[model samples]
Target: MNKVKLLNISIDNISQAEFFEKCKSGVVFTPNVDHLMKLQSDPEFVNTYKDATYKLCDSKILFFISRFLGTPIKEKISGSDLFPAFYQYHKDNEDIKIFLLGARVGVALKAQEKINAQVGRTMIVGAHSPSFGFEKNEEECAKIIELINQSGATVLAVGVGAPKQENFISKYKDQFTNIKIFLAIGATIDFEAGNIKRAPKWISEIGMEWLYRLLAEPKRLWKRYLVHGPSFFWLILKQKLNFYVDPFNSDYSEPYKGVTREEMG
Candidate 1:
């Protein structure tokens, strides 16, 4: 597996077709500007990323950044796109049962219903909508884990935002003895349930999805896009110039650790 380095993280330089063919079992995390920005300051999130089996480029902006860095990523595999494709690809595979966790109180169930209808089968076997700050409650997490295990789901797709989703998966992944694939997919459940509409394909292709999302939920996403997002460009520039330093460790400045050839299998 070839990976491209960005700041302190490595993104798999794989296309969607390649991802489908090779992704048998592992944790999948889609990294975007917001995620990268958070990674700079969030040590736990950075550590959690080390546990990721597939650090996929989830933003067109990242694609452009990779190109600018002279190590272009093969594709931008957003969780929103990947989740649907994954279910469709495995629609006929009886053993590929998926459990969707996240979204609002009823949204995961709606996504489950819609996805099953689209696939013409119940590929999403279980759906859970955890309460606000549910990850903090050990009892709730235990119950959720138990529910997923009882559902016989082989895959777990968690759509809670950012570090919480990743952190939850990292902490409790070992508990789910039956789960093979873990996807930390943010807002995908909302898209599937039609609770939120994605940006137009052209907008996404042209790298304006951030603007589209900012416009859609300005109050919620303004800080992510308008405030924290600009820092990512600056950081990318620093990385390009070999001047970027990991905030967690002032001595670490080696951002050009490119093409990590790992035995993912």
Candidate 2:
């Protein structure tokens, strides 16, 4: 897979189809500004991304910034977008069982119900909404891990929010003998369940989805959008101007450096 480094993180430069083709089993992290910013302080989060099967671009602002920095990412492959596509791809793939982990109480169940109703099949084998800080309790974590393992799910969609989802998987992934795919999809469970409405298509196309999200939950998202968001643009400027130490430096190795699916085919 071809990749480019943005903020010292390896971001896959692949089309949506290529993304689906390549994703098999392993952690997937979609790095937005918030995630990238947090990476500066979170070593575990950084390692999680480093070990991910797919480190996709999650934010349009980050995509624009990548272009402005002259190391363009090919596309955005957000978990919210991919979750629906997962169902679409696996609609007839009964063998590819899925599990939903980490939503508010009943959210994943509702999402599963909606998927079953609309898709006309039963793909989700299990859904769990762990209590807050359940990870802190060894007994609870063990029980949940065992439940997931027993579900025999091939894909696990985790929505407990960033580092938590990633950490949860990291801590117990080995126990998941049947699971192959895992997505650390923050709040996508809410979106999938219709608990939170998505923005209009036009808004998303114009890269104003962030604005819509900000307007949707200003109380919870203001600091992320209004405060930390500006710093991203500044970081871009710094990268563009070569104004900082090791400005825009990327040491990422793309093993499939010049390869593509079409060419391989």
Candidate 3:
């Protein structure tokens, strides 16, 4: 498990199996609304992307979780639901060391305190709150790498939001050889730290998590859930119609089969 290269990301080439193999410790499988929107725009491109994503999710060595509003199925759980499971696993197995990175100013510290109080001597090695932005100074990047390496943590939970967090892990993966797992858990740190309230179980179970999120933070998420939500459904419909006539002989409609989109299409 030392320096295993599982992910292959090139400009013109990508493989899903490689990504899954790389998650021997653990990996994050995040699907933001924006990514789904991008997929809806181009089924071929998205199918390729999702193929790689789902392969990674299927890894047994890696803990799979998605940070999304509504999934295709009713019984699927959100990333928030899996956080406690991850915590409990670490609590039971003292060999796994965790490092918390990113979140609001004091959110990481608060989360560390909460987990420690609850778990009673959990195996959290260290925690830090990184500044929000893409361009990181040399000093900042060096500091983060040094902290992770010195902390001796195997799992690192990053909460700096999409693309940014993913890019950060890609940039620094080689620096922390001891780090086996890297999770880009968008806003889970805030929710776990009690900085934000999660939606009720009933609301989440019914796939109305988007509505609850909109009510909670309308200004920030209105464009994402409200505007983009219907747009996704519309794109789904269009793809369905295209599949029915076999215009291009594409298989985009099969992934969402037995669902409303399949019936309507």
Which candidate comes out best when scored by TM-score?
1
TM-score on alpha carbons, each prediction: 0.95, 0.89, 0.69
Candidate 1 lDDT over residue span 1-265, tens digit each: 8888888788999999999999999999999999999998898998899899999999999999999999999999999999999999999999899999999999999999999999998889999999999999999999999999999999999999999999999999999979999999999999999999999999999999999999999999999998987888898888888777767655444554342324211
What are the clash counts of all predictions, listed in order? Answer: 0, 0, 0
- Quote model 3's TM-score: 0.69
Per-residue lDDT of 199-246 in model 3, one digit per residue for the tens? 887876556777888899999989877787676555445544433222
The lDDT values for all models are 0.91, 0.78, 0.58
lDDT of 2 by residue, 13-59 (tens): 99788877767667888888888777756777766665687888887
Return whichever of 1 and 3 wins on lDDT.
Answer: 1
Q: Rank candidates by lDDT, best first.
A: 1, 2, 3
RMSD versus native structure for model 3? 9.3
